[model samples]
Every structure is written in C-alpha cells, then in structure tokens.
Target: MTKKVRSVRPDTSFKETALALIQNRLSGVPVVDRQGRLVGIVSESDLLPREALDDDLLASAQAFFEGTFDWDSLFKNRKAVALTAGELMTTPVQTATPHTLLRQVAKRLSESGLRVLPVVDHGKVVGMVTRHDVLKVYCASDADTLCNVKDALEHRGYVPPRHCIDASVHEGIVTLGGTTIDPEGLRRALALVRAMDGVVAIRNLVRVDSSAG
Candidate 1:
C-alpha cells in the first residue's frame, strides 16, 4: 500500500474539495472528521451533478487559444455552487482494514468501481490504495532480473530515451521507466519489455512530444 493519501474534511466546500480532487487527478477523496476518522468518500460522480465548471474547462477544448478562467466571475455568477463534503459524499463507504488481504481489496475495489480505498485501522484512516499501487506490487519482479531484462532490451533494438529508464524485479514483476517517446513508441517499447521473462508489468513515464517543433 502507498503511504500517500488524499483527504478532505466534512465541512470542506464542495467546490473547493472537488477542485482538490481534480488537481490531484484522483478519483475520490476520503472525507475525514476532526479526529481524522474516515466518514465518507467523495468522488467525481458526486461533483458531476452540480454542473460545476472546472478551472481548466475550455469553451472549445480542441482550440489552443482560450481566455483565462475568471474564478471571481464564476463565483459571483453562482457558477460555483456551494456544497459540503458531507452532503455530497457516499456513506457506508467500502473500506479495508489494515490487515485485509490484498487480493480481497483488489476484488472489492474492482467490482465496486472505486478507484481508491481508504485503509482503516481502529476506525481511523491510515492509508490509501489505488489501482496503480496494486499493479505496481505485481509488476516489480526483482532487481537483477529487471536489470537483465533492460540489458537485453538495449541489446535488442529497444532504446531507453532518457537517463531515467530504470528496471526493478520483485516477486517476478518488472517495472520500466525513464524514457520519452510518442504514444506509439511507448506502446511498442512496453510490449517488448513485457515479452521478457518474469516481466509482469511496466511503469512508463515516457512523455510524448506533441508539438510540431
């Protein structure tokens, strides 16, 4: 489980809390109380009903040129609706105890369509679980095996575009990163990496240069 957790207070404004979720690109935020106990879960679905406009929402998203977001105007015009985390959150939240089995947690989250799960211990929020963390656990195989795989790839025609390309193997999972390329290249590279022995996954930070520069 990852140490990083995103949380909000029950009294937090709906707009403010939703903005925080967007800022983090998180599917949901844990609603905590004064003592940091998990009370509810707030997700994007909770914000969608308000017809709120995000800070980066463009009139025409495809067009590169757009006016700056006037937050003050948005607020004054009541474009920003007032909501509290408590009013918008989902109660009886599905949760996992700290000692809950990983497979169980994965299954529950998968079936429920929840992107993140709050790790609770003694009825208090302690950590969080996301799909990425679950995948990372299975993808990192072992250090030496990952290094050998990287070496084999380098020997083969696959190139690591940046100094950041790294490999890790733990429990037969492989993670690769530190490369930059277009989406097609990334897909090809990751496919090749997955072809290696004991490579169960690849964590890619490969950036695509979309500019015509």
Candidate 2:
C-alpha cells in the first residue's frame, strides 16, 4: 500500500479536481473532509462524459450527423457545467483495512474493478492500495519467498541443533518440516512464513519437542 496518497476535498471544483488528476497523473482521487476522512472518489470517467460535450471532436461528430449544432442548449446542459467533487464523486466507497489479507485485497479489487482501494484504520484513511501493489506480491518468485522465510527464522534464532526448521516452497506454498525444541520458536517461525508475501499456504510437518528447553 502507498502511504502517501493524492486526494481532494469534497468542495473542490471539478476543474480543480481534473487539474489535480492531470498533474498527479492519476485516473482518480479520493474525496476527503477537512479531517482527512474518505467520503468518496472522483474519476476521469466521471468527468469525461460531461467534458466531451464541449470537445471539438464531439462538435465535429455532431456536425457530421446534423445540419446544425445547438450551441445554446449544449451550453445550458447541467452536465456541461463545471461541478464540485461532492456532486461528481461516487459515495459509499469500498475500502480495505491495514490487516486485510493480500488474497482478500486482490479479490476485492478484481470483483469491484477498482484500480485503487483506500486503506482505512479506525474509520480514517491511512494509505492507498493499488492493483499493482497486490500484483507485486503475486509476482514474487517461489525461491525468493523460501529464502525470506528461512532468513526470518534464522534472524529469530530458530536455527539447527536448538530449533530445527526446514522450509520447502513449491508454487508459493511452503512446507515446513523438522523438529523444534521450543514451541514458541516454532510458532514464531510459522507466523513469519504465513505473513510472507507470495506464500499461498503453509504445511506444518514439524514435530514439537516439549522436553527440550
């Protein structure tokens, strides 16, 4: 998730929002209140249909079909007029929490067809997660995931002789096998591997030795 997010206020004008999107090179931005709570989101698709009415391309197309253009009626159309973010933004926005699992985040983005999802905590926007962010996890190599898991266990002092944990990765699923003298160390190792990116699941074949301390 991107900690720094580009957002706009509800009262911000459509022109300003469009300019912000252009300057930031974003397709959409979340609408927030003065307190920085996400209320809605506005996108280029929301504005493009209205903005297209004023474009030369639209005029040319209209001219090709009709003998004359109704300039006065076009100008009078409410959609042609610049509105505010509050008027244009879609509400009841879908969001994700910081603790949300990567698989769930990916599922939501796929089902909703949303490019970005605001990460919220305690009812306030904390960061933003994009499809690219989720994709990075899925794209991680199995070897990389296994190496990271082993490194994490070693860092936590779950090593051979004292705490033996061997890991094997096949298509992103990790199978942990061996013996652990310390149950706490085994738990920590499992937790570390489970939390790792690209780890689809874990198979725990480790036998815990409660006698050894």
- Judging by lDDT against the true structure, name the best candidate: 2
List model 1 lDDT by residue over 1-213, tens digit each.
645666789889877888867765668888999998899998877777457455434432423355555656544434234478887788889998887866678787899888888889998878778877666654543775667777876765455543334566557766665545456656767777765544555666555655622
Scored against the true structure, residue 123 in model 1 reaches a CA lDDT of: 82
Clashes of each: 11, 0
Highest TM-score, which number?
2
Candidate 1: worst 10 consecutive residues by lDDT?
A: 55-64
What's the C-alpha lDDT at position 200 in model 1? 58
Residue ranges of candidate 1 with Cα displaced over 4 Å: 23-25, 52-82, 142-213
Q: Report how far off residue 163 is in candidate 1 (Å).
A: 46
